[model samples]
Target: MDALSLLANPTLRDIGAGAILVLVVLMIITGRLIPKATHDREMKTAITRGDEWKQTAEETVKVNAEVLSQNSQLIKANEVVEAFLRSAGPSPADTSPVGGP
Candidate 1:
Protein backbone atom coordinates (compact mmCIF):
# COMPACT_ATOMS: atom_id res chain seq x y z
CA MET A 1 0.00 0.00 0.00
CA ASP A 2 0.91 3.68 -0.19
CA ALA A 3 2.78 5.36 2.73
CA LEU A 4 -0.30 7.14 4.10
CA SER A 5 -2.40 3.97 3.79
CA LEU A 6 0.21 1.99 5.66
CA LEU A 7 0.32 4.58 8.45
CA ALA A 8 -3.51 4.59 8.52
CA ASN A 9 -3.55 0.91 9.49
CA PRO A 10 -4.30 0.56 13.20
CA THR A 11 -1.75 -2.21 13.74
CA LEU A 12 1.01 -0.29 12.02
CA ARG A 13 0.07 2.93 13.86
CA ASP A 14 0.07 1.16 17.21
CA ILE A 15 3.43 -0.38 16.51
CA GLY A 16 4.85 2.93 15.45
CA ALA A 17 3.43 4.62 18.56
CA GLY A 18 4.87 1.96 20.77
CA ALA A 19 8.27 2.30 19.11
CA ILE A 20 8.15 6.07 19.61
CA LEU A 21 7.23 5.63 23.25
CA VAL A 22 10.06 3.23 23.78
CA LEU A 23 12.44 5.67 22.10
CA VAL A 24 11.19 8.50 24.31
CA VAL A 25 11.64 6.41 27.44
CA LEU A 26 15.13 5.36 26.37
CA MET A 27 15.97 9.00 25.62
CA ILE A 28 14.72 10.04 29.04
CA ILE A 29 16.69 7.36 30.80
CA THR A 30 19.90 8.13 28.93
CA GLY A 31 19.31 11.87 29.35
CA ARG A 32 19.22 11.42 33.08
CA LEU A 33 22.00 8.86 33.32
CA ILE A 34 24.53 10.33 30.84
CA PRO A 35 24.79 13.75 32.45
CA LYS A 36 25.09 12.21 35.89
CA ALA A 37 27.87 9.98 34.62
CA THR A 38 29.49 12.92 32.87
CA HIS A 39 29.13 15.15 35.91
CA ASP A 40 30.66 12.53 38.17
CA ARG A 41 33.56 12.04 35.79
CA GLU A 42 34.06 15.80 35.49
CA MET A 43 33.91 16.24 39.24
CA LYS A 44 36.55 13.63 39.80
CA THR A 45 38.78 15.23 37.20
CA ALA A 46 38.13 18.68 38.65
CA ILE A 47 39.02 17.50 42.14
CA THR A 48 42.29 16.08 40.94
CA ARG A 49 43.06 19.22 38.99
CA GLY A 50 42.00 21.33 41.96
CA ASP A 51 44.56 19.67 44.15
CA GLU A 52 47.24 20.32 41.56
CA TRP A 53 46.08 23.93 41.23
CA LYS A 54 46.08 24.32 44.99
CA GLN A 55 49.65 23.17 45.18
CA THR A 56 50.65 25.49 42.35
CA ALA A 57 48.83 28.37 44.05
CA GLU A 58 50.57 27.63 47.33
CA GLU A 59 53.94 27.47 45.61
CA THR A 60 53.21 30.76 43.89
CA VAL A 61 52.29 32.37 47.19
CA LYS A 62 55.45 31.07 48.78
CA VAL A 63 57.55 32.41 45.94
CA ASN A 64 55.73 35.73 46.14
CA ALA A 65 56.39 35.91 49.88
CA GLU A 66 60.06 35.24 49.30
CA VAL A 67 60.13 37.92 46.61
CA LEU A 68 58.34 40.35 48.93
CA SER A 69 60.84 39.59 51.67
CA GLN A 70 63.69 40.24 49.27
CA ASN A 71 62.01 43.43 48.05
CA SER A 72 61.58 44.65 51.61
CA GLN A 73 65.24 43.99 52.31
CA LEU A 74 66.15 45.88 49.15
CA ILE A 75 63.92 48.77 50.23
CA LYS A 76 65.57 48.86 53.63
CA ALA A 77 69.00 48.87 51.99
CA ASN A 78 67.87 51.67 49.66
CA GLU A 79 66.67 53.65 52.68
CA VAL A 80 70.01 53.12 54.38
CA VAL A 81 71.84 54.29 51.24
CA GLU A 82 69.57 57.35 51.01
CA ALA A 83 70.16 58.20 54.67
CA PHE A 84 73.90 57.84 54.25
CA LEU A 85 73.89 60.02 51.13
CA ARG A 86 71.86 62.69 52.96
CA SER A 87 74.23 62.59 55.93
CA ALA A 88 77.29 62.80 53.70
CA GLY A 89 76.06 66.09 52.21
CA PRO A 90 76.92 67.05 48.60
CA SER A 91 79.66 65.01 47.07
CA PRO A 92 82.73 66.57 45.39
CA ALA A 93 81.29 65.35 42.10
CA ASP A 94 78.43 67.87 42.51
CA THR A 95 80.81 70.88 42.38
CA SER A 96 83.24 69.44 39.77
CA PRO A 97 83.02 70.75 36.22
CA VAL A 98 83.23 68.57 33.09
CA GLY A 99 86.62 68.47 31.34
CA GLY A 100 86.89 71.05 28.57
CA PRO A 101 87.43 69.77 25.03
Candidate 2:
Protein backbone atom coordinates (compact mmCIF):
# COMPACT_ATOMS: atom_id res chain seq x y z
CA MET A 1 0.00 0.00 0.00
CA ASP A 2 0.95 3.60 -0.47
CA ALA A 3 2.16 5.81 2.43
CA LEU A 4 -1.16 7.75 2.51
CA SER A 5 -3.13 4.52 2.82
CA LEU A 6 -0.78 3.26 5.54
CA LEU A 7 -1.34 6.39 7.61
CA ALA A 8 -5.08 5.97 7.25
CA ASN A 9 -4.94 2.52 8.84
CA PRO A 10 -3.27 2.67 12.28
CA THR A 11 -3.43 -1.00 13.31
CA LEU A 12 -0.98 -3.68 14.41
CA ARG A 13 -0.79 -4.92 10.80
CA ASP A 14 0.84 -1.56 9.85
CA ILE A 15 3.64 -1.81 12.43
CA GLY A 16 6.22 -2.12 9.70
CA ALA A 17 5.19 1.20 8.16
CA GLY A 18 5.41 2.93 11.57
CA ALA A 19 8.85 1.52 12.20
CA ILE A 20 10.08 2.75 8.82
CA LEU A 21 8.77 6.26 9.53
CA VAL A 22 10.54 6.37 12.90
CA LEU A 23 13.82 5.25 11.33
CA VAL A 24 13.61 7.95 8.62
CA VAL A 25 13.02 10.63 11.26
CA LEU A 26 16.01 9.45 13.27
CA MET A 27 18.24 9.42 10.19
CA ILE A 28 17.28 12.96 9.25
CA ILE A 29 18.04 14.21 12.76
CA THR A 30 21.41 12.48 12.96
CA GLY A 31 22.66 13.06 9.40
CA ARG A 32 21.50 16.64 8.80
CA LEU A 33 20.40 18.50 11.94
CA ILE A 34 23.18 17.44 14.28
CA PRO A 35 25.95 18.26 11.82
CA LYS A 36 24.48 21.66 11.05
CA ALA A 37 24.43 22.53 14.75
CA THR A 38 28.06 21.49 15.16
CA HIS A 39 29.12 23.51 12.11
CA ASP A 40 27.39 26.63 13.45
CA ARG A 41 29.18 26.26 16.81
CA GLU A 42 32.57 25.90 15.12
CA MET A 43 31.96 28.97 12.95
CA LYS A 44 31.11 31.05 16.02
CA THR A 45 34.34 30.01 17.71
CA ALA A 46 36.38 30.88 14.63
CA ILE A 47 34.79 34.31 14.37
CA THR A 48 35.59 34.99 18.01
CA ARG A 49 39.22 34.07 17.44
CA GLY A 50 39.37 36.35 14.41
CA ASP A 51 38.03 39.27 16.44
CA GLU A 52 40.73 38.73 19.05
CA TRP A 53 43.40 38.76 16.39
CA LYS A 54 42.03 41.97 14.95
CA GLN A 55 42.23 43.63 18.34
CA THR A 56 45.82 42.54 18.78
CA ALA A 57 46.73 43.85 15.35
CA GLU A 58 45.22 47.22 16.15
CA GLU A 59 47.24 47.49 19.35
CA THR A 60 50.42 46.55 17.54
CA VAL A 61 49.82 49.25 14.96
CA LYS A 62 49.42 51.85 17.69
CA VAL A 63 52.67 50.80 19.30
CA ASN A 64 54.49 50.94 15.96
CA ALA A 65 53.20 54.42 15.33
CA GLU A 66 54.53 55.64 18.67
CA VAL A 67 57.93 54.09 17.94
CA LEU A 68 58.05 55.75 14.52
CA SER A 69 57.26 59.14 16.05
CA GLN A 70 60.06 58.76 18.60
CA ASN A 71 62.52 57.75 15.87
CA SER A 72 61.67 60.83 13.79
CA GLN A 73 62.23 63.10 16.79
CA LEU A 74 65.61 61.50 17.46
CA ILE A 75 66.65 61.94 13.81
CA LYS A 76 65.73 65.66 13.92
CA ALA A 77 67.70 66.14 17.12
CA ASN A 78 70.77 64.40 15.58
CA GLU A 79 70.58 66.62 12.50
CA VAL A 80 70.53 69.75 14.66
CA VAL A 81 73.63 68.62 16.61
CA GLU A 82 75.51 67.82 13.37
CA ALA A 83 74.66 71.23 11.88
CA PHE A 84 75.85 73.02 15.03
CA LEU A 85 79.18 71.18 15.08
CA ARG A 86 79.81 71.95 11.41
CA SER A 87 79.18 75.66 11.94
CA ALA A 88 81.36 75.93 15.10
CA GLY A 89 84.65 74.91 13.32
CA PRO A 90 87.76 73.64 15.24
CA SER A 91 88.53 74.91 18.78
CA PRO A 92 91.61 77.10 19.55
CA ALA A 93 93.18 74.33 21.70
CA ASP A 94 93.51 72.14 18.57
CA THR A 95 95.52 74.92 16.66
CA SER A 96 98.96 73.68 17.96
CA PRO A 97 101.66 72.92 15.36
CA VAL A 98 101.12 69.40 14.11
CA GLY A 99 104.85 68.44 13.87
CA GLY A 100 105.91 69.78 17.30
CA PRO A 101 103.43 67.83 19.44
Candidate 3:
Protein backbone atom coordinates (compact mmCIF):
# COMPACT_ATOMS: atom_id res chain seq x y z
CA MET A 1 0.00 0.00 0.00
CA ASP A 2 1.78 3.12 1.19
CA ALA A 3 5.05 3.43 3.19
CA LEU A 4 3.56 1.38 6.04
CA SER A 5 3.67 -1.76 3.89
CA LEU A 6 7.51 -1.48 3.53
CA LEU A 7 8.32 -1.90 7.24
CA ALA A 8 11.12 -4.06 8.65
CA ASN A 9 9.48 -4.09 12.10
CA PRO A 10 6.44 -2.09 13.25
CA THR A 11 7.72 -2.05 16.89
CA LEU A 12 10.43 0.47 15.91
CA ARG A 13 7.72 3.13 15.75
CA ASP A 14 6.73 2.73 19.45
CA ILE A 15 10.41 2.73 20.57
CA GLY A 16 11.10 5.91 18.62
CA ALA A 17 7.98 7.60 19.98
CA GLY A 18 8.78 6.65 23.59
CA ALA A 19 12.34 7.88 23.28
CA ILE A 20 11.18 11.21 21.93
CA LEU A 21 8.59 11.62 24.67
CA VAL A 22 11.18 10.88 27.37
CA LEU A 23 13.62 13.41 25.95
CA VAL A 24 10.91 16.09 25.76
CA VAL A 25 9.85 15.46 29.34
CA LEU A 26 13.45 15.69 30.59
CA MET A 27 14.08 18.91 28.69
CA ILE A 28 10.93 20.53 30.04
CA ILE A 29 11.58 19.60 33.66
CA THR A 30 15.24 20.62 33.63
CA GLY A 31 14.50 23.85 31.78
CA ARG A 32 11.99 24.93 34.42
CA LEU A 33 14.15 24.01 37.46
CA ILE A 34 17.84 24.55 36.58
CA PRO A 35 18.10 28.23 35.60
CA LYS A 36 16.09 29.51 38.58
CA ALA A 37 18.34 27.60 40.99
CA THR A 38 21.47 28.96 39.33
CA HIS A 39 20.19 32.56 39.45
CA ASP A 40 19.19 32.34 43.13
CA ARG A 41 22.62 31.02 44.14
CA GLU A 42 24.46 33.69 42.16
CA MET A 43 22.36 36.43 43.77
CA LYS A 44 23.20 35.11 47.24
CA THR A 45 26.92 35.08 46.43
CA ALA A 46 26.80 38.69 45.20
CA ILE A 47 24.87 39.81 48.27
CA THR A 48 27.45 38.21 50.54
CA ARG A 49 30.27 40.03 48.75
CA GLY A 50 28.36 43.31 49.10
CA ASP A 51 27.98 42.68 52.81
CA GLU A 52 31.74 42.14 53.13
CA TRP A 53 32.40 45.38 51.28
CA LYS A 54 30.00 47.27 53.55
CA GLN A 55 31.69 45.89 56.66
CA THR A 56 35.12 46.86 55.34
CA ALA A 57 33.93 50.41 54.66
CA GLU A 58 32.58 50.73 58.19
CA GLU A 59 35.85 49.47 59.67
CA THR A 60 37.91 51.92 57.60
CA VAL A 61 35.80 54.85 58.82
CA LYS A 62 36.20 53.72 62.44
CA VAL A 63 39.99 53.40 62.14
CA ASN A 64 40.30 56.79 60.47
CA ALA A 65 38.27 58.42 63.27
CA GLU A 66 40.45 56.81 65.96
CA VAL A 67 43.68 57.89 64.23
CA LEU A 68 42.40 61.46 63.86
CA SER A 69 41.36 61.57 67.53
CA GLN A 70 44.79 60.35 68.66
CA ASN A 71 46.56 62.86 66.44
CA SER A 72 44.48 65.70 67.91
CA GLN A 73 45.31 64.58 71.43
CA LEU A 74 49.04 64.44 70.62
CA ILE A 75 48.96 67.99 69.22
CA LYS A 76 47.31 69.29 72.42
CA ALA A 77 49.82 67.47 74.63
CA ASN A 78 52.78 68.89 72.65
CA GLU A 79 51.34 72.40 72.98
CA VAL A 80 51.01 71.98 76.73
CA VAL A 81 54.56 70.69 77.10
CA GLU A 82 55.97 73.52 75.02
CA ALA A 83 54.11 76.08 77.18
CA PHE A 84 55.60 74.54 80.36
CA LEU A 85 59.10 74.60 78.90
CA ARG A 86 58.76 78.25 77.85
CA SER A 87 57.45 79.23 81.29
CA ALA A 88 60.46 77.50 82.97
CA GLY A 89 62.82 79.85 81.04
CA PRO A 90 66.19 79.11 79.36
CA SER A 91 69.66 79.91 80.83
CA PRO A 92 72.19 77.48 79.39
CA ALA A 93 75.64 78.34 78.02
CA ASP A 94 77.88 75.91 76.05
CA THR A 95 81.51 75.83 77.39
CA SER A 96 82.87 73.90 74.43
CA PRO A 97 86.02 75.06 72.57
CA VAL A 98 85.27 77.00 69.37
CA GLY A 99 86.98 76.54 66.00
CA GLY A 100 88.59 79.56 64.39
CA PRO A 101 87.24 80.57 61.01
Candidate 4:
Protein backbone atom coordinates (compact mmCIF):
# COMPACT_ATOMS: atom_id res chain seq x y z
CA MET A 1 0.00 0.00 0.00
CA ASP A 2 2.70 2.45 1.06
CA ALA A 3 6.49 2.67 0.18
CA LEU A 4 7.71 0.28 2.90
CA SER A 5 4.94 -2.18 2.15
CA LEU A 6 5.76 -2.02 -1.53
CA LEU A 7 9.42 -2.76 -0.88
CA ALA A 8 8.46 -5.72 1.28
CA ASN A 9 6.38 -7.21 -1.47
CA PRO A 10 7.78 -10.50 -2.92
CA THR A 11 7.87 -9.13 -6.47
CA LEU A 12 9.93 -6.06 -5.39
CA ARG A 13 12.38 -8.25 -3.43
CA ASP A 14 13.86 -9.50 -6.70
CA ILE A 15 14.35 -5.91 -7.92
CA GLY A 16 16.13 -4.94 -4.67
CA ALA A 17 18.32 -8.03 -4.85
CA GLY A 18 19.40 -7.14 -8.44
CA ALA A 19 20.29 -3.57 -7.44
CA ILE A 20 22.42 -4.83 -4.51
CA LEU A 21 24.25 -7.24 -6.85
CA VAL A 22 25.00 -4.46 -9.35
CA LEU A 23 26.37 -2.26 -6.55
CA VAL A 24 28.72 -5.05 -5.35
CA VAL A 25 30.05 -5.65 -8.88
CA LEU A 26 30.74 -1.96 -9.45
CA MET A 27 32.53 -1.67 -6.08
CA ILE A 28 34.83 -4.56 -6.95
CA ILE A 29 35.67 -3.15 -10.40
CA THR A 30 36.46 0.35 -9.13
CA GLY A 31 38.48 -1.07 -6.26
CA ARG A 32 40.84 -2.79 -8.73
CA LEU A 33 41.03 0.09 -11.21
CA ILE A 34 41.68 2.92 -8.72
CA PRO A 35 44.89 1.50 -7.15
CA LYS A 36 46.36 0.65 -10.55
CA ALA A 37 45.75 4.21 -11.73
CA THR A 38 47.29 5.67 -8.56
CA HIS A 39 50.36 3.46 -8.84
CA ASP A 40 50.92 4.54 -12.44
CA ARG A 41 50.76 8.20 -11.49
CA GLU A 42 53.25 7.78 -8.64
CA MET A 43 55.71 5.94 -10.89
CA LYS A 44 55.57 8.69 -13.49
CA THR A 45 56.34 11.29 -10.86
CA ALA A 46 59.32 9.28 -9.61
CA ILE A 47 60.75 8.94 -13.11
CA THR A 48 60.48 12.66 -13.75
CA ARG A 49 62.28 13.43 -10.49
CA GLY A 50 65.07 10.99 -11.38
CA ASP A 51 65.61 12.67 -14.74
CA GLU A 52 65.82 16.10 -13.12
CA TRP A 53 68.39 14.87 -10.63
CA LYS A 54 70.52 13.45 -13.42
CA GLN A 55 70.43 16.70 -15.32
CA THR A 56 71.45 18.66 -12.26
CA ALA A 57 74.40 16.35 -11.62
CA GLU A 58 75.59 16.72 -15.20
CA GLU A 59 75.45 20.48 -14.98
CA THR A 60 77.46 20.45 -11.75
CA VAL A 61 80.17 18.30 -13.33
CA LYS A 62 80.40 20.63 -16.32
CA VAL A 63 80.83 23.67 -14.09
CA ASN A 64 83.51 21.97 -12.00
CA ALA A 65 85.45 20.98 -15.15
CA GLU A 66 85.40 24.55 -16.42
CA VAL A 67 86.71 25.85 -13.09
CA LEU A 68 89.51 23.28 -13.05
CA SER A 69 90.54 24.23 -16.59
CA GLN A 70 90.72 27.92 -15.67
CA ASN A 71 92.80 27.14 -12.57
CA SER A 72 95.29 25.08 -14.59
CA GLN A 73 95.74 27.83 -17.14
CA LEU A 74 96.36 30.41 -14.41
CA ILE A 75 99.01 28.19 -12.79
CA LYS A 76 100.84 27.76 -16.12
CA ALA A 77 100.81 31.53 -16.72
CA ASN A 78 102.28 32.15 -13.23
CA GLU A 79 105.10 29.71 -13.90
CA VAL A 80 105.97 31.40 -17.19
CA VAL A 81 106.07 34.84 -15.53
CA GLU A 82 108.28 33.47 -12.74
CA ALA A 83 110.73 32.06 -15.30
CA PHE A 84 110.93 35.41 -17.12
CA LEU A 85 111.64 37.34 -13.89
CA ARG A 86 114.43 34.94 -12.94
CA SER A 87 116.13 35.43 -16.33
CA ALA A 88 115.95 39.26 -16.05
CA GLY A 89 117.34 39.49 -12.47
CA PRO A 90 121.00 40.75 -11.90
CA SER A 91 123.72 38.03 -12.03
CA PRO A 92 126.44 37.47 -9.37
CA ALA A 93 129.14 38.66 -11.81
CA ASP A 94 127.29 42.00 -12.29
CA THR A 95 127.08 42.56 -8.49
CA SER A 96 130.86 43.22 -8.10
CA PRO A 97 132.49 46.60 -9.23
CA VAL A 98 133.16 46.82 -13.00
CA GLY A 99 136.76 48.09 -12.31
CA GLY A 100 138.73 46.43 -9.48
CA PRO A 101 138.48 48.14 -6.04
Q: Say which candidate scores most in lDDT.
A: 4
Q: What's the TM-score of every candidate structure?
A: 0.53, 0.52, 0.52, 0.50
65 in model 1: Cα distance from truth in Å? 0.8
Clashing pairs in 3: none
Worst 10 residues of 4 by lDDT: 92-101
lDDT of all predictions, in order shown? 0.86, 0.86, 0.82, 0.87
Candidate 3 or 4, higher TM-score?
3
- Report the C-alpha lDDT of model 1 over 1-101, residue by residue, as the tens digit: 89999889988776766798888889888775356778899899999999999999999999999999999999999999999998887666676555633
How much RMSD separates candidate 4 from the native structure? Answer: 13.1
Cα lDDT, model 1, residue 46: 97
Clashes of each: 0, 0, 0, 0
The Cα RMSD in angstroms, rounded to one decimal, for candidate 2 relative to the true structure is 9.0
lDDT of 2 by residue, 1-101 (tens): 99888778868556787787887789878774356778899899999999999999999999999999999999999999998997795666687776656
RMSD, model 1, all Cα superposed? 9.2
Candidate 3, residues 1-101: lDDT per residue as tens digits?
A: 56666455677565776787888889878775357878899899999999999999999999999999999999999999999998785535645555532
Clashes of 4: 0
